[model samples]
Every structure is written in structure tokens, then in C-alpha cells.
Target: NAGVIQTPRHKVTGKGQEATLWCEPISGHSAVFWYRQTIVQGLEFLTYFRNQAPIDDSGMPKERFSAQMPNQSHSTLKIQSTQPQDSAVYLCASGRDRGDTQYFGPGTRLLVL
Candidate 1:
């Protein structure tokens, strides 16, 4: 079964460090979503794309967080100057379209110390 793939299932970074998370969406899927899960926030939507173009990122942090889809196969989420509060499980999901059922990756758990 094809599914979204997330690299570096776990990451540990010191405060002020930079963290980059990678996601590979299911082949042929046109929509991708990024989310963050934390004890305080629970699950929070970060961004989403359609046809490899950003559709919305209003949920993303104004600073320090950025996401990009340079191609149809992959997307990346980067956090600059990572703080302890940035620690969370980053999730990636892919779907054929915005309304389609999204398949999620195993997620990457990041810890900032």
C-alpha cells in the first residue's frame, strides 16, 4: 500500500538550533498537508498544498516556520531558531484532492532542549 513517508522519525535539537523535516507524499497525490501535534495544542494545522502549489498557510507560525513543495513528490518543513516550545510531532498527509481522504505518514517527533 502506498502511503506518505516522513524521514527522521525522531529528532533532538538544542534551543536556537535549526530543524528540517522531510515528507514524501504518495505518488499521484496532488494535495499535501502539514500539521503539528503537541501536548498543549493537541493537533494544529500548519499548511496545505494543491498541485504542488501552496493553497493555505494561515495556521503556520508567522516566524521561524516555513514549508515548501518544490515538486510533486516531496515537501519540507523547516523551523529556524527552534525553541523548547517548538517540540512536537510533525505530521504529513497526502490526498488526491482537497476533499479526498488523506493518508498520513508515521510523523516525525522533534524535541528541542
Candidate 2:
């Protein structure tokens, strides 16, 4: 398996701009997770997918934050009207089951200007 891959290792966006981050999970894995990491908040769960369906998104922001699992192996997270408060390391993880240990990809760091 290829583990997990995340593109655009770093992103810079101006205030009010939009930004998108991509992720590709390990082959055959059915669970994927998104988390945001910052010095103050630590790691905050954003959303998750199981069997290509969203299972939980309770941790996601009510506005401007969205996540999608378009297929079995890939997912994306988009942030609209990017703000300085949105700057963080966006991490993608995947595993065979919800309780299984997840393998993390090198995160995409977003910097809002």
C-alpha cells in the first residue's frame, strides 16, 4: 500500500481567499480522518469518513469548512474565506477501521496572509 499522500505540502492564502487541500489514503483502507493542529488548540478532529461515507463531522466548524470523500481512496478539505485564524497544519490519516491505529501523512501547512 502507498500509505497516505497529501499534496501542496504548504499553502499560502490571502484573507478571504479560498484554499483546498488534497489527500490520498492507503489502498483498501476504508477509514479516513482530518485533523487540524495548532500550538494553542493542539490537534482538533475535523471530520471523518468510513466506507466512503461521512461518519462524523461534529468537530468541524459550522461555516466555511467542508470535507469530502469523493472515492474510496481519496478525500479533500476546503476552507472558504480563509482567515489568519485558519492557519494550521492540516493532517490526513487513514486506517482499516475506526479503532485501528491510523497512519498519518505529511501534513499540509496553511498560512493565511
Poorly placed runs, candidate 2 (over 4 Å): none
lDDT for predicted candidate 2 compared with the true structure: 0.95
Candidate 2 weakest lDDT stretch, 10 residues: 1-10
> Candidate 2: which pairs clash?
none
Q: Count the backbone clashes (under 3 Å) in each candidate.
A: 0, 0
39: Cα error in model 2, Å: 0.5
Q: How well does each candidate superpose onto the true structure, as a TM-score?
A: 0.97, 0.97
Error of 2 at 113 (Å): 0.5
Candidate 2's TM-score: 0.97
lDDT of 1 by residue, 25-89 (tens): 99999999999999888999999999999999999999999999999999999999999999999
RMSD (Cα, Å) for all candidates, in order, is: 0.7, 0.7
Question: Model 1 RMSD to the real structure?
Answer: 0.7
